[model samples]
Target: MFNHPQAERKLEIQPNCIGDHVRRETVAAIEVSGDHAARSHIPKITALTLQCRGGYTLEAELGISPNGYAEPDYLGWEVKQYGVRDFVNYLAKSPVTLMTPEPTGGLYREQGVEAFLRRYGYPDKSGKPGRINFGGIYANGRDFHADTGLKLVLEGFDADKGKITNVDGQIALIDRDDVVAASWGFRGVIGHWNRKHAKAVYVPSLMRAPPPEYAYGARVELCEGTDVLLLLGALASGAIYYDPGMKMERADTPAPVTKRRSQFRVRHNDLTTLYQASVHENIDP
Candidate 1:
């Protein structure tokens, strides 16, 4: 559906080192186009890259399945892209959905997704009975609640312990009645961290809406895996907030679904800790 001869040619060479070539070719594809540079109907940068490259394939073709395992986007390099209003302001938001299998021994987990929905499902703006996805800023020894009136208490955690202290002061989220509805154990978070494809090349793009289009290759950043560690630290420090995404109620199923996307988000300025090097350039009209 898209064509870029320059990028295709460059990709054909299949240089021994493909990471840098992908970056350069990506930039060229975006830069060469004038007003027509904007590609409507492509909502995400990943899709845009596939279109521009004109030949290279994505996750599947690269032998990476969704949520299967961590691997580089291509040639051992992970590519991430973000859109911004201007070069100065860019928000780095990633979904951290590890809260699954629920909590093995918690009351809510015992209740199961369907029962949980029946108890806490509230009408959304559209008045559809939507399951609540509970989230909040957490700190050591702080307390929070789920939509089903379940209370959760957080305690400072150590990697060795692999668990936190809940309201009863027992091991958190395990064998508890009034504990948090969901739990992200130390092992869970660490497991996610370990599987994450590190050494990413971040692409910041300038975007416009209505047609849902984008102009990418405005800037590129090289980030290390340690940045994810910093993100975890920020979570402990409360700089980042948990905002879980909820599954909308559907008539086809008996119960509404909860996506369990344990998203931790930071403000725009906070991105500096995640990136090591940055290069900015302007695209010509």
Candidate 2:
């Protein structure tokens, strides 16, 4: 909330609002309908049959794709990883200007976002008597990928202060069954944003293995550090807004670290506003 009539509209342009790119918080908030709910993985695979490759006839019969005999098997695909976005495509196309205003001297001066606003009049209030904080919007969009995905929920702890005994560079999150759970990488930081629906997020530097699709947890271990979920707040800790009615599969990664740490802190937006023809949230003021 700001006094300006256009401030709210500008904030909507941020990642938490609508755009072509994917964001976990936004995805969780959306009421996925029809084929989208059942088949979100189709975006990953396309044109396996018409690729013009010939070899294994048995692959097509056995439901495998050694050659270009059949279409991609969307059902057997892997989980979508983090940072697999086309954001750079948009940034590359954005215009660049030289007469951008330079911040006289302040935190804004170092970041250089003020220059853009002073150079190009923000979508509204042309040359208004104020500085535009463009970095806030940019950072919000970047965080969509920065602190997201299965890894976002992974946690780590201080070696000397926390209960990290194994120190073998990897650990499993499990109950009594001994089933392998979430995996933690070498060194990382688990950050939590200030939000009600937010989850404790793992800001890992290197994440190769992802949690199983629809899995509950993963046996998380790390070389740099580790952290386990607390019993008191465990059940509701990393509670994502996954639909109870949805046919969710058990996740593949481990979860002992964040069993009680909510991963996704989504701010549910009003879908009613989206349907309101006269009330435009993304109005170009």
- The TM-score values for the models, in the order shown, are 0.55, 0.17
How far in Å is the alpha carbon of 90 misplaced in model 1? 5.5
lDDT of 1 by residue, 1-285 (tens): 123211121111111223352233332232223333223432323433442221122222223333434444545556545544455544433322222223433444677654544554444544554334434443333454443344333344432443343322211331135445555554555444444534455554444433344444333555443444454555555455454444445523665455543344555455455444334333332
Residue 167 deviation, candidate 2, in Å?
Answer: 10
Q: Candidate 1 overall Cα lDDT vs. reference?
A: 0.40
Residue 99 alpha-carbon offset, candidate 2, angstroms: 38
- For every candidate in turn, the CA RMSD to the true structure comes to 8.6, 26.1
Flag regions of model 2 displaced more than 4 Å. Answer: 1-172, 175-179, 186-236, 240-281
